[model samples]
Target: MPNRWLCLLLLPACISAVTLDCKHIRIDKKDFDLSALGGPKTIHQQRWLPPSISNTTFTIDLCNPLKKLKGIDSKEQCPSGTRVCGIEERYNPIDGVKEVTEVRPIAGEFSTSHGRAMDPEVTRLKESSNADQEGLRIELRGGKFPETRQGDLQKAIIELHCDAELTGNEGFEDDEAAVDVAGYGSMSKRAKDDKDDEDEDEPELPDLDKGKSLQFVSYKNEKDDVGVLRLTWKTKYACENAEKAPAKEPGNKSSGWGFFTWFFVVSFLLIAAYIIFGSWLNYTRYGARGMDLIPHSDMIRDLPYIAKEWVGGVADRMKSGGSRGGYSAV
Candidate 1:
């Protein structure tokens, strides 16, 4: 009975852990519709990561006002007459709390074209009620969100979709084209919607093979103050049946000669052929005696004669020196 009483006491604290004043902190619901676009479809995949995301931005509107703005703070203790439109809280996939970022609100009303208007009395009540509340235009800007990996070495499949009309590419023909991800991964076309036969076997096409069986991990839809909706998801790629590319053979390394190499080889052969042709012409014109006209044979024949002359000269010098030595001593 005491344990039950303890649980009852903890429940209220858990509910009020994140104290967001919903009435004062109002976001135009029309600005953010998670279901505005079609369901999430697989758009991209990577060997071990999601689609490259550099930075993120969130535009918000606070009821009252601040002239100069920097960024959103974690505790959200903004100056007076400014309402807290939204709080930017970033959470890691694995680690719990990465940051409680600031909420920057623009200094204007929500555009009528962009979203519906709130009641004038309700707006007045929000400002009059909260002392530290001011209307603001907040843009939450932060560095790239940290990417965490799965426990095991698993590929990540990223699904993406956006409303073409909202993104201003309504007439774009290939907006729905499959994203061929660096050839390491591929996106498949969404399956044809069949309400009556959900269990029917799908045709085994090249793009729709077993490589696409991604296990669902989590899903989220992000929409800015504009009506544009971006749907994204992260899942584990079905890599069990992923086919491995064949290893390159040693013979394939030198499969073809390049232009310069081929040119040098052909030039060498042509020069050799030209030399042989000239030699044959000389031989036909002047018989075997023409071979003696070649400088190679002439140099070989003179080598022995030159050596003999050099030896004779050295012997003559030695004899002269011996004769002069005996005479000088006398």
Candidate 2:
């Protein structure tokens, strides 16, 4: 009985652990759809340190786990459910070789939060003087660095900028262009073939050019902190007015008559009905004929004379100019 109660209590938390829907992100009563930017993006940075050159590659996917690309090794990448991963390699000039130094899971979890501090935090970026800078910021902080003694948590901060011209896939010539997966070339032929087979099962990435793709701005690692990585991305989906209710089709007419139109229509119908009934009643009862059969005949006939006299009165008033006949007091 106690186990049953515990299961019931845990059901709500499990149900709420589903992945976030990037298509409809509601912020400040406005919705921004980023589904167009859904796919893994890889970035590389190289720095010279003493005799060896250090190269770092970072991969992230907002909508799902990173796919198995051609050059990236499964072992060097993040764990199965990671959303962001970073790997660093050092090249020695003397040995003419490169060595994989670190594989860091920057953000993701094996399962639900379960009271752990593993949930991703998303918030709106503060607006600046430049309109293009408006966007969202996401902070992911559950991954751990494998080299840290204290099991230090890894953090990744992603800033999305609003760029209508970008689709987020710009500058990447091919899927494997930017990826330098460590140890991939050293694998045996059989292992390489197996990896290739796995990659073939995955869906092909879209062929996108710089004209309509997401633009990668920059990546910065805080010098004071080794566990933090900040990256900036520009896409049209980050704009405030990215998605709105689709406009009505041009060929479709309005659903119904407007207020004034209905009012005038109803009014004309009522007046016509009244006149027809009055004329019919007069002809039946008194055998009326011609103009006499019309309702309010006298008033209708006098309308033209009444209008003429009103116009003459206005003309006389204008000519008199409200002047006194006698001389004005001096």
Candidate 3:
């Protein structure tokens, strides 16, 4: 399970190396004048301008119609380049006068209404400023929403930077040291493989045979719920000082290395526990059962007597046992 998750995680880090598309992060904070008695830092929402779209304008006309009403012929849509086209009526053949009636055009056929993005899942990350420190930079990917023309502009559009923690448990293919931005762990669907079981009786458990596993994580102070900027990110200012840089320690190496260091610390504790626990079992079960006959080989071997009878002994008392807490022992 860990292996699959590791692969999934490593895939991104690997790609990041080939192409570092991380956007520039700016933590906008106001520095109080020395005269002002120690003011704390504050985060202000900033509206980011999208990159320009070459050979295109933000202003596009609404769809124009094919036919106009007799009385409404003088009226036109709000913006130019709007088009709305539909089929007009055709007259039916009649015997007497053979008169033809005009068909009217409807609006739905070809029309353009200002459309907004749907399902914009905005994610945020902590980024650094000119100085490398903890900050947030939102990352957006293509989803159900339409691909935004890089030049869409809006008034008072504020970015809500998220603070969810993410982690990567993956390894590198070429044994190169991976850059782990954060220690905190992080963040999709499937189709039916079995044709027979369209209607399942029991709930299908997630397939773990391939080593894929789900990561549990959480966040706080979510400003909004609906959508965030598409193809854009919101990075927060560094909580710590942007200047007065700290140095990275040389002792720590790779993520896997950290695991062994910590894992061994736990393993050694468990081993000591087993040794002490096994000694206690041996002394309790057959401390003096047959000392002379018992060989040292059987007493303290690598594999302790695993049988429940030896370890989980029977508790019994020599007769007259009903007398309030009689001499009963293990």
lDDT of 1 by residue, 1-330 (tens): 999999989966753432222223333321222121111122221121111211112212221222224463324433322221222333222222234343332122222322212212212112343334322112211111111122111111122222221321122223222222222212212222332455645332223112322222221223322211122221111111112212332223555789999999999999778767766766777663555534355666889999999999999888787575556653
Runs with alpha carbons beyond 4 Å of true place in candidate 3: 1-14, 17-139, 145-330
- Predicted candidate 2 versus true structure: per-residue lDDT over 1-330, tens digit per residue: 999999999976863554555766777787877765666777765654534456676777886766655676777666776788877777554345677787878776555532223466667775443445688887776677663456656777778887777655666545442434343233333333444353433222222223424333444445544467777787777778775422332333567889999999999999999999999999999899999999999999999999999999999888888688747978
Per-candidate clash tally: 23, 6, 23
C-alpha displacement of 108 in model 3, angstroms? 35
Score each candidate by Cα lDDT.
0.31, 0.65, 0.25
For candidate 3, lDDT tens digit of each residue in 51-142? 10011001110111123334432322112211111111111111111111211111111112333211111122233332332333322211
lDDT value, residue 51 of candidate 2: 45
TM-score versus the correct structure, for each prediction: 0.16, 0.54, 0.17
Worst 10 residues of 2 by lDDT: 200-209
Positional deviation of 249 in candidate 3, in angstroms? Answer: 20
TM-score of 3: 0.17
For all predictions, the C-alpha RMSD in Å is 29.6, 19.8, 27.0
**Candidate number that wins on lDDT, 2 or 3:** 2
Kindly report which residue stretches of model 2 are placed more than 4 angstroms away from their true locations once superposed: 2-18, 68-74, 93-95, 112-117, 127-132, 147-149, 177-226, 244-330
